[model samples]
Target: REIERDALRARLRSHTGSRAELAAQLGISERSLYRKLRSLDRPD
Candidate 1:
């Protein structure tokens, strides 16, 4: 399943924890989170 970009952005904005922690909360790997963020930066 894919995560929504807006939801990801909202979580990132509100999150005060480290990337690893956020990844754990989202049930994804830290590397996956980074990839998602990177994809969000690119032109769809």
Candidate 2:
């Protein structure tokens, strides 16, 4: 999960599009993307 989160963060850093676009590219809703990010920030 940490590796996945790191990859997501890297992708976000390199992506120039809006969050919605990124979410669409990932096949997830914008809200789901935000939720995943928030969860990744929490201690496991």
TM-score (C-alpha) between model 2 and the true structure: 0.81
- Residue lDDT tens for model 2, 1-44: 88889989898999999999999998999999999989987999
lDDT of 1 by residue, 1-44 (tens): 24599899999999999999999999999999999989888877
Q: What are the lDDT figures for the candidates, one per model?
A: 0.92, 0.91
Model 1: how far residue 1 lies from native, Å: 9.8
Q: How well does model 1 score by local distance difference test?
A: 0.92
Stretches of candidate 2 off by over 4 Å are none
Which residue pairs in candidate 1 have backbone atoms (N, alpha carbon, C) closer than 3 angstroms, thus clashing? none
- Residue 30 lDDT, candidate 2, scale 0-100: 93
